[model samples]
Target: MDKRRIGEFEVSAIGLGCMSLSHAYGAPPPRDQAERVLKGALDEGYTFLDTAAVYGLGHNETLVGEVLGDRRGDYVLASKCGLSRGTERELNGHPDILKATCEESLRRLNTEVIDLYYLHRWDRRVPIEDSVGALAELVAQGKIKAIGLSEVSAPTLRRAHATHPIAALQTEYSPWTRNPEIAVLDACRELGVAFVAFSPVGRGFLAGGVRDPAKLEPGDFRSGMPRFQGEAFEANLKLLEALEALATEAACTPAQLCLAWLLQKDPIIVPIPGTARPKHMRENAGAAAVRLTDDIIRRIDEQVNETTVTGSRYAPAMQASVDTERTPAEAAA
Candidate 1:
């Protein structure tokens, strides 16, 4: 896989997102299976790994630490703070809390200094400048090499970057989720910050993994997502047919086609698609090699997008937490 720069560090174009190992999707894989995926990612040539403190309330970071801590030198490690620990979701970007979160993350990650530390979500109650300033202190103390922000708008990104050079900005970006295109993408390029894309396969929808949401495991979080629900899913599933056909023509899996499209979209974009199965990890890594033509890219843009897709990315309460720019329709809604 070709390498991309996350600030000064060069990492693989396709990174491994470690969330599914301990949280989010469903019942996590058995320890052996999870270990296989973590070890296999490095063997598959993935040079970037992303995790967060809120995932499984620190379980995810610990899992990454236990499994891959010995080989920490092999890849650039990224983790997030600001999202508070609990059974329910919450955001706490207070400087003291952020600093405290970093201390725990470092201990859990089994690292001396995290490569890229991001403020997972901006707590609206706390100014972004102050939150970023806390991160800047970590950089100064050699606790983190660089700072990042996730699920923030272009304007918020500009403000955070002004306070401190944001190494990267991450969000749920895919063919189906086009929020970043609203302005964040342009902002990253202007500021020379890497744009890290999470859920690059439409949260497994485009991967041909979940044909029927009714059959998803009982605890799988996608079962609760708007795009996976009844009417919206039915409408969205039709869009997948066109995507699957394009994948067939492109000679790649739908998941790979999605990642390849993002890779070809811009030089600074890095897609971190997560998986619990090592086979899927290898398959996602293969996407870095899948080349897409302009025609295929154009068709993908035309077929699956904010306008064509049904349902918003998040429900009202969850949506209120993020600072990302909403689509015109979403804004009006």
Candidate 2:
């Protein structure tokens, strides 16, 4: 994998998201399997790992900590705070919560400092500056090496950046999820902030690996996602056919083709594709080596433009939380 600069730190261009090692995607992988996958990722040249305090309620971070153990310094550790889960999901950007969360993340991650710490979501109840100010304090104290924000609008990012330098901004950006191009991508480029793309494979949908949603286990996160449900699932599969055809022409897996498309779109963008299986991990990492030509990138963009995709990225309720600033009413109908 190639190395990319996230602020002052150099990390793998194709990072690994450890969320599936704990929860969301499906059943958690066995401890031995998860550990092996983590170790294998580092062995294969992946130097960036992403997790969060809320992912499996911190189980994911603890797993990474236990697996990586004394080798923490070998990779750039990135995690998120702000989004909290109690009776329901809550976005808490209060300074006190930020401080408390960082302390807990440090303990669970078994790291003295995090390379990059992100606010998982924008807390509507608090100003973004307040949250970012608290994160800046952590940087001053050397608890966090850099600051980042997730799922935030361009304006919100600018406000937060004014409080402190945001090293990166993470958002769902793939052929199926192109909303970031509206403003987020341009803002990141304008501000010289790196853009980390999570779900760059559309949560594995664009890979042609997911043929039937019914095969997904109960409680799988995809069960709740709009694009993976009923008619929407069938509609979206048609779009994947075009992507798969292109992948064949590129002599790469559908997943790799999706990632290659993103790489060609922006030099500052890095896609973190997660996997609990070692083979899948290696396959995803190989995408960085797949050189996409200008013609290929343009064909991809022309085929995957808004008219081709069939469903919204998130469910109606979850969509409201995205920092797009549009009212739910406007987004729904």
Candidate 3:
């Protein structure tokens, strides 16, 4: 696999997002299967692994620790703080909370130091400076090697960088989710921070695996997503048809097409697509080798975009949690 820079670490161009193995889309995968996916990613040359404390309320980190802890030196380890589960999901970016969270993550991850630590969600109640200051302290103490921010706006990124250099900025970015284009991408380019694109395959929709939202597992989060419901989902599927044709022409799967598109977007962009199945994990890793032509990329731009996509990426309540920049139409809504 090709390599990219996330701060001082040079990792695979396509990293593995270890979320779905333990949390999110639905019920957690069986322990043996999840472990195979984790170990398979390393064997597949995915040198960067991303997980967060909040995922499955610490289950994800613990799984990663158990499966990959023994092979820690083989890859770059990244985890998030600030947002976690107590009695319920919570966001706390206070210095003390961050420090304590790091301690907990360290124990759960079974690692001495995390390679990249992120403030999962900017706690609106706390200033970005304070949150980043706490991360800076972690850096100083060698608890984490680099600091990262997720789902943040450009201005927020600048403020945090003013506090301390941000190694990376992660958010949901795919053909259908164009929020990052508003400013965060340019901000990261300007500040020399890497941009990590999560859900690069449109949250499994682009992979052609989720044809019916109703059939989704009982607790599957995508079932509640706007684009996966009723008329919105039907419209989005139409967009997917054209993308699938393009993928065929490229001799790749729809998921690889989505990932390759992001890889070709910019050198600073690294997509950490997640999956529960080892087969899909290998397919995602293969995207780094799938090249897209200029005309194909142009057609993809014409076919899928903010204006063409149906429904909001998140519900109103979920939307309010992120600090990502919004388009005028979305902001007005």
Please list the C-alpha lDDT of all candidates, in the order they appear: 0.93, 0.87, 0.92
What lDDT tens digits, residue by residue, belong to model 1 across residues 1-333?
899999999999999999999888889899999999999999989999999999989899999999998999999999999996533355899999899889988999999999999999999999999999999999999999999999999999999999999999999999999999999999999999999999999888989888999999878888877889999999999999999999999999999999999999999999999999999999999999999989999999999998999988787778989899999768876
Cα lDDT for residue 238, model 3?
94
- TM-score of candidate 2 against the unseen true structure: 0.96
Best by lDDT: 1
In angstroms, the error of model 3 at 7 is: 0.6
Comparing 1 and 2 by TM-score, which wins? 1
Mind giving the per-residue lDDT tens digits that candidate 3 earns over 1-333?
999999999999999999998787878889999988999999999999999999888888888888888899999999999998432478888888889888988989999999999999999999999989988988999999999999999999999999999999999999989999989999999999999999999999988988989889988998878889899999999999999999999999999999999999999999999999999999999999999999999999999999998888888889999899986657766
What is the alpha-carbon lDDT of model 3 when measured against the actual structure? 0.92
RMSD of each: 1.1, 2.0, 1.0
Instruction: For candidate 1, give the lDDT of residue 327.
Output: 92
Name the regions of candidate 1 deviating beyond 4 angstroms. Answer: 86-89
The order of the candidates by TM-score, greatest first, is: 3, 1, 2
Q: What is the lDDT of candidate 2?
A: 0.87
The lowest-lDDT stretch of 10 consecutive residues in candidate 1 is 82-91
lDDT digits (tens) for residues 205-234 of candidate 2: 998768999999777888888779889789
Model 1 Cα shift for residue 328 (angstroms): 2.0
Task: Count clashes in each candidate, considering only residues at least 3 apart in sequence or on different chains.
Answer: 0, 0, 0
